[model samples]
Target: MTIPIALTIAGSDSSGGAGIQADLKSFAALGVYGASVITALTAQNTRGVTGIHQVPADFVTAQINAVFADLEVRAVKIGMVAELAVIDAIAAGLTRWLPKHIVLDPVMVATSGDRLLAAEAVEGLRTKLIPRASLITPNLPEAAALLNEPLAAGEAAIESQGRRLLAMGCPAVLIKGGHGQGAESIDYLVRDSGVIALAAPRIATRNTHGTGCSLSSAIAAGLAKGEDMETAVRYAKAWVSAAIAAADRLGVGHGHGPIHHFHRFY
Candidate 1:
């Protein structure tokens, strides 16, 4: 039995809502074997994060080496790297392994529109890591942060940002418009070929804590299963939409709860 495998290099959320937990859940839900390399440990629940303990850069490198050394990892999703050194270590690991697909969710901006990474770390990420990704998935504020521009309020501006980001060395960029106000949530997949707009009906629910992490991991799962970039992205969006639609049933947390990753089975 040849099961596809995907790796997630990210922080661990104690609440199991976001970060590494969400990534692993998304991988399993999508039928891909999951492996992980944790960069940090976060004290967080659905309400918010309270504390974080970053793993030492060398230890992070060790974890990455351990996973890549054993697993037949077909794709990788990266998230929540808190330090410049950690970013450097992750970039080094990617350079070593050369995974077929690398999905980078630039998890630098929070839902409250706050910067999560230090300025230097952000610069390191921009320079060293972004160029190595097969695709970068950035929310509106994150994309703006990467380009040091104002939030794009329309399609043309979003595409322009995507194009600029693509020039930053990533072959493709997914500009997610979840922060935008509308009946539909739209995400743009910008490649040299053109932009593909993926839209889904916006679900009204507070239980969306892990949406970005899960979406990117789902994309990794699809890629691990041998889907093309567009197909993987389309399937991920649809799957995440359904998970968000079904999130209310979980009743897990008081504020911004997690989506039901296993919504299909239970």
Candidate 2:
């Protein structure tokens, strides 16, 4: 039987709520085979990240090479690149492989208010990685960091931020409104053609630790299965919403718990 494969290049969250672990789980939940290239490893839990150890950039490149040489990677979800070297390495690897669907989740901070990406690496991500991605999924803070402006407030400003990101060279941009104050969560998808707004009722829960990672990976899975950008994003948003709705039941961690990735299965 033929199986669809998706790749995640990110960090390792020991808590298993975010980063590579969450990405792999999302891929599996969506019925897509998952491959991973870990950029860094963190000693972390639900409470917070205590320490971090970055994998060598060359080693990251080797992992990418091995994956692309053997597996037919249908889509790639990139997250939590901590250093400039790692970003450069990932950019080089992507350029070499030229994967069909690239989902760049610009993971800058952890839910525990810990910064994941180095401040100096932001330029590398903006210049080297952003241009290569098919889509970039950035939350309010991340988007603001990229653009060097305050978080866009409300629908109109959010749409403008999305357009600004698109102007930065990424073919498409999804500006997530999860951080906004509202009864509903609104996400804007801006492309060269136009913008598509996605809204879902907000689910109040602390179990949203890995949400960004999960959503981006889910989108990659949808793309791997041959869905269009809009369709993939729509399905992914729905999947994440369901996961969030079911998250409170887990009760795994004391701080921000993880969403139920396999909520549909069990």
Candidate 3:
């Protein structure tokens, strides 16, 4: 049987709880073949990030080309792009290869309060990369950063920001409400058609290190398997919720452990 394939273009988390590792796990768990292009090497764990080494823009391009040269990369998920040059490289590669589904996760910060994206690169992300994406998954702060505004306060404000983000050139925006304060984590999937609110009960667990990466990759996996945007987002939300709920079962790290990406297995 031929399996659908998804690609992740992101950083490497030495801890194996986030970034490329998490993306691959999410793809496999969702029954998709996975490929990767590593953009950065991060010395990070559940607690925080201590060091980062960026891969040269040319090498990043090489990796991207190598993957697209052979693999049937149906969908792509991008995460933790830390430099302007790397962003440009990824954008150029995408233009050349043209993956059908692009899920851009504007991963700016780690769960343990470490900045992942550089301040100067944010502009590149806004102008060069965001437009090329099939969907952008940005949390509250990320959305605000993209808009050069304060964090949106309520659902109304959040939806408003999502709509404004759409004007930036992407066809759809998923303003994630995981950062919001509530018993329910509601994500707003705003398209030109309308807004879809996907809600899941917030599971109280510190093991949310790779939640965003996993969620975005899961969406990519679904899209690779031929599911539409809304269906993919809804399925990802439910799957992530279950993973978070089962997270406590795994005794991994000292803080902010990874969600059980294969929670359904054992």
Pairwise lDDT winner, candidates 1 and 2: 2
Clash pairs, candidate 2, are: none
Single out the weakest 10-residue window by summed lDDT for candidate 1: 109-118
- Against the hidden reference, what TM-scores do the models get? 0.98, 0.99, 0.99
* Runs in model 2 lying further than 4 Å from the true structure: none
For 1-266, candidate 1 gives per-residue lDDT tens digits of 89999999999988898899999999999999999999988888887777788899999999999998988999999999989999999999999989989999989754433345667888887899999999999999899989999999999999999999999899999999899879999999999999999999988888898899999999999999999999999999999999999999999977888998999999
Model 1 residue 119 distance off true place after TM-score fit, in angstroms: 2.4
Worst 10 residues of 2 by lDDT: 151-160
Query: Residue-wise lDDT of candidate 3 within 1-266, one digit each (tens)?
Result: 78999999999999999999999999999999999999999998888999999999999999999999999999999999999999999999999999999999999999999999999999999999999999999999999999999999998999999999999999999999989998999999999999989989988889998999999999999999999998999999999999999999998999999999999998
lDDT of each: 0.92, 0.95, 0.95
Number of the top-ranking candidate, with lDDT as the measure: 3
Compute the lDDT for candidate 2.
0.95
